[model samples]
Target chain A: MSILVSNLSKLYGDAKAVNNISFEVHSGEILGFLGPNGAGKTTTMRIITCYLSPNAGSVKVEGRDIQTESFEVRKLVGYLPEQNPLYLDMNVLEYLEYAAQLQGVTKLMIPRRMKEMVDVCGLGEMKHKDIGQLSKGYRQRVGLAAAMIHDPRVLILDEPTSGLDPNQIVEIRSLIRNLGKQKTVVLSTHILPEVQATCNRVIIISRGKIVADGPIEDLQRNLHGGEKIILEVEVPGGQSFEMVSVQVRSIPAIETISLVEERDGVKKLSVETSNATDIRKDLFQLCVQKGWGLLELHREKTSLEEIFRQLTAH
Target chain B: MKFANIKYIFQKELRSFFNSPVAYIVIVVFLVILGWFFTSNLFIANISSMRTVFEMTPFLLLFFAPAVTMRLISEEKKSGTLELLITKPVREYEIITGKFLAAWALYFLTLMPTLVYYISISVIGKLDLGPVIGGYLGLMFVGAVFLAVSVFGSSITENQVVAFIVSFLIVFGLFMLDKVLFYLPSTLASTLEYISVDYHFSNIARGVIDSRDMIYYASSVGFSLFLGTVVLQKRRWS
Candidate 1:
């Protein structure tokens, strides 16, 4: 594991910020940290990055313990905090140099690395501009460039795409994707699409606990115990809607059937199955025998949005 | 424990100080006030010594020290950059010491323009160089202690105005310690006088340069900076 966090817990007075959460990030994996606001995602990230020492348990980054060897761990971890903090009074290049030097980057590599960051973060136009003068999107870019300036192996970014426009968001997503090929990344965000677009694995935290953790596909596939089939059909003249519904309801595998729409003498029905079984063949045969014209048929898997809402709703 | 980190932080803070209007304003104001006090009696009585400026600086520093240090850590806290800063490979003491040195350097720079007072006095008359050098050293020593205390104050709060008031009160307390000697009993009065910042500054300003006074200034600066580091370490707990 590139980063190992085991049973880590942090308490703020009587409340818990991170409640015995444990997870790890492997080398060269982009892990999406998914949670709602105040879900302890940032708190956990702070602990892993050696900013906050855990009240219980421990964290190890690249074989170095965070509490005992935090300096070494900090040298290996590149963190862009949730707020995207930068010295607004300093220009982009100066701030980046400060960050690079603080991370222990060699003086010889700093200039070359700074150029790399500016190009990667698209900060060419605003390199010498004061950070306060830049737009919010541009400021966020500077924060990213500073975080990556030292070229550390582990990148922990919180809401890296926040305050970015559509074009910049895509650009940053691809940037993270490109970096994740060799570096371990733990990205935290409440935005779902960015995670789906950038991260290869995800861990959903809720109320200071890990509620969901897996690949996105596995998260979606495992949460759903049933499947949905949307069927558009043309019913024969003699068959009334009630009669056709009664016959369709007779199938044992079909759990529920609801009329989605009735337009231009055709009915669109949503059929829900009781298990992960193929019912499309059975439905098609029934439609043929019942003299119903099958216009469309396909299965709709549960989306990540639905899974996120389901796990965090209660 | 890295020396480079301290240098980086020092350079960054000092650069930001000059990049903004605050440093220039502080230096200009300090010079204007000191100039007024220095020249007020220069032509009237024809005194060529820098005695007036030296005597007036310790009291003036109660505000100057806090003004230079109010935003040292408080601005980082309010802007959330403190997290970014502390998470780097630097230790807490390095940051506190770096900022303390930067504020002290600004104090030194602010006092630089007053050299004209020393130069003009020496050129006109047989002015003593010993006390002038000692007085400058004494004022800088006092400035270092006050700036360290103000850093501690700034570390505890995220508001610059509150930081200014807190450090101003603390530095004012130090400034007024010897002045209020009559209010206490004999033994306590002696102890407070010995602990006061002005007692040591006065000893050095009179060209004494005693080891005891140097130790007092060094210990006070060290103790205040250590307290600032403690406050920073305690922040994660809150």
Candidate 2:
């Protein structure tokens, strides 16, 4: 294991920010910390980074304890806070050098690591530009570069992709995926698709408790009731819509089917199944036999919002 | 505890100071105020001592120190950058000490141009080098203590203006306690006198660098820096 958190509890006045939460991150794994607003995602990341001490338990990064061996644990973990704070006066390279030096990087290796981080974060063009002049996306990149300057074994990024446009989000997600190949990464975000795109496993937190934990597939299947797909099929030249709908309803694996739209002899239906089965092959074979063109067959991602609402509705 | 970490923080802080026009504005205003006082003492009073420069600086530091340190940690806290620095391999003491030294260094540099007074005096008249050097040393210690106090002030609050007012009130008390000494009984007078920065400063400014004065300055700076670290650590536990 790379990071172990055990029974960690933090209290803010009378309320608990993190309550007896425990989990572990294996080496070379990307763990998405999924949570709604005020769900203690940032608090957990803070505790793991040694920025805050747990009220009742401990965190161990690598083999170093956060409470006792924080100096060593700090050396092993790199943190990018929720705000992605940076000294806006300094340029990218200057801030990276400062971060590297603060992390106790050797003087000889400072320049080498600085250059490597700039290249890794795609910050070469903004190396000398003042951070305040850069856009939010570039500033976030600088924040990432600063966090990775010391080349630590574990990276704790809190809402790393928030406040980014779609294009920037894709760029940062790919960067995170690349980093996950060699380091243990715990990325926290409320975007469900973000977790699906970059993380291998997810831990959904609500009201300071771990509401769900497992692979993304398991979480969706367990709480969501079923997988869903949008199927758009073209009607045969002579057959009516009734015939196609009847044939589609005959498939036993599909428990529910509803027509979402119909126009110009093309029909869009939502298919929901209770279990993970490759029904696309079955649907395609049916379409081939019926002489219907498969206009579109896209799986719909189960929204995490509904799961959070169901769990936290009380 | 690591000097490397402290150095990094120190350099970053110093860069931030110079990057804005605030540092230049403060330095220029400081020089103009000190220059006006030094020249008035020389031409109007017809005095040739570094006494005026020494006397005016501690009073000037009442506002100057707070202005220098008001944004140090307070801005970091407000912007949430303190978490980024603390989570690095740097210790709490390192962060406090680094900022303390940066503010003090800026103060010392601000005092540099006052060297013109000593130079002008030596060229035109007899100059007593003893009090001049001792006064400079005393002023440095005084600035260090004030800056440390303001750093402590900055750590306690997230608002920069609040930090400034807190330090202003504290150093103001330390500066004013000496003037009211004659109004009190001898025992209490002596106690407040010892606690007052102006009392020890006068002692050293008279060309006497007593170990007691040195001890007072060191302990004051140490105590204030310690309090600043405690404030920062309280945030972690809280």
Best by the DockQ measure: 2
Ten residues in sequence with the least summed lDDT for candidate 2 chain B = B1-10
TM-score of 2: 0.93
How far residue B181's Cα lies from its native spot in candidate 1, in Å, is: 0.8
User: What DockQ does each listed candidate score?
Assistant: 0.82, 0.85
Give the CA lDDT, 0 to 100, for residue A155 in model 1: 95
The models' CA-based lDDT, in order, is 0.90, 0.89
Query: Can you write out model 1's per-residue Cα lDDT over A70-187, one digit (the tens) per residue?
Result: 8899899989998798888899999999999988889999999999999888899899899999998899889888888888899999999888899889988998999999899999
- Cα lDDT over the full model 1: 0.90
Best by lDDT: 1
Q: Residue by residue across B29-50, what tens digits does model 1's lDDT show?
A: 8888888887987887787788
- The clash count of every prediction, one per candidate, is 0, 0
